[model samples]
Target: MGIITDIVLPVSLAFIMISIGLTLTLGDFRRVAAQPRDFLIGAVSQIIVLPLVAFALVTAWRVEPVLAVGVMIIAAAPGGVTSNLLTLFARGDVALSVSLTAITSLLSVVTVPLIVVTAHQHFVAGSGGEVAGDLTVTGAVLKIFVIVTVPVLAGLAVRHTMPGFALRFEPLARRISAVLFVLVMVGAIYAERANIGSYFAQAGAITLTLNIAMMAIAFYGAAWLGMRRPQRIAIALECGLQNGTLAIAVAASLFHETLYAIPAAIYSLMMFGTALAFVFLVTRGRPAAV
Candidate 1:
């Protein structure tokens, strides 16, 4: 477990972030400024609305304090590399999806810690439990900056200076990152293998509900607001397929609780099924409905 958290988790997450960075360029960031409306909507959905929805869920459901913090951990995560790939598969705005992932990921340096700390305070600390010792927003921000932001900026630098090498290596990097993701998932569940059933049973319902609700809210909200079909698909899927790897790392590293990482582990396992169904539903049906 120590090896997993200390070595496997951080390295795997760093590689994933680097892989995401491989897909990004300066233009992706510029796209945020160029198309401010969609970006704003996507950002607000993930940053503000997603956490709000999660808080509402945890509070209303009266989830246990540790698991409740786990719920908020996943909620605080940004869109993963999978979101961009799934966006492409869903016939959505690939560029917009990539832009959102890149932008939100960078923003998570600040936002992830903010949400995690708040959740810890409200759910864990407020419950009069011994909270994860000394977890502060500022401390989490620094950890995320090192684990996420620095690797990402390094990836961008590599791509910028050595475009040929980056393009050649990106596919392999992505495959490696995917393998790392699976390893992390297996390790997390295996470490808690004894508790897997009880943990999953307790956390699964809430995580699944959170996934479906957010996707529906984002997709329908975008549609109702008259956003383009592709953009709607992109944002909705982005909201659904969060960076659960990052969430797990945050929980384990900061809170040092496998208990707190349970929701993210369960969530990583299930989000794909829901996302695929959504993609199938829209693609098989009429685009006009969107």
Candidate 2:
């Protein structure tokens, strides 16, 4: 299990992220500059607001310290490729969705480490002193860069160099990513099976609360800011669905703690159900695409 968590999980996560990159083009980044207001709204909501919300929830719930940090780690993770698919299905702005995913992921190379280190200091060290060989900001930053950023950049390179090939392979890549995600979820659950029920009992409600709150905040906040329906839907899904595979991999590979990965695995399951219901509500009377 250690070998699988430490080795296979990270590698698989990198592949999933690379597959995401393969779907991206330079235009995805350019779209942010093209429409700065919409992009900024989504980016701020994702990179800033969501983590703050997660922290507040964990602190309010008096969650176990390690699990609190784990939840924070999930919050710090960038939006997943699943958001793009959900956006498409929800009749949202798929371009904006992809742009947010790409930008947040790149920014997470910085934000994730900062948030995780802060959570560790506050929850882990502040409460009970330090754990030796604990994850440091520098190590977290480097590992995220290597595992997340590098693969994404490689995928972007592939897209740029072979546009046709990239397009042709994207559907298959997405399918592969889906499969890898399931396997990672299984690995995480299996690794923590002994304590699965207790972990879920501990973090399940908190994670569910976090997920629903984020979606509502994103959707209502975007609407309040007068964003169009499509953009609102995009923001809602992006904020709601995190990159759980990355979160789990980070916990298992970087922290080597099954308890740390439990929140992510549970959150992954919770998000799908919530996201589907959201899709149903938003799409009931709307056109297929806006």
lDDT of 2 by residue, 25-51 (tens): 878878878899999999999999999
The superposed Cα distance between candidate 2 and the true structure at residue 9, in angstroms, equals 0.7
Q: How close to the true structure is residue 73 of candidate 2, measured as C-alpha lDDT?
A: 86
Minimum summed lDDT over a 10-residue window in model 2 is located at: 129-138
Query: Considering only N, C-alpha and C atoms within 3 Å, which residue pairs clash in candidate 2?
Result: none
The digit string of per-residue lDDT tens for model 1 on 52-99 reads 999999899998999999999999999988888888778999899988
Worst 10 residues of 1 by lDDT: 281-290
For all predicted structures, in order, the TM-scores are 0.97, 0.97
Q: How accurate is candidate 1 locally (lDDT)?
A: 0.90
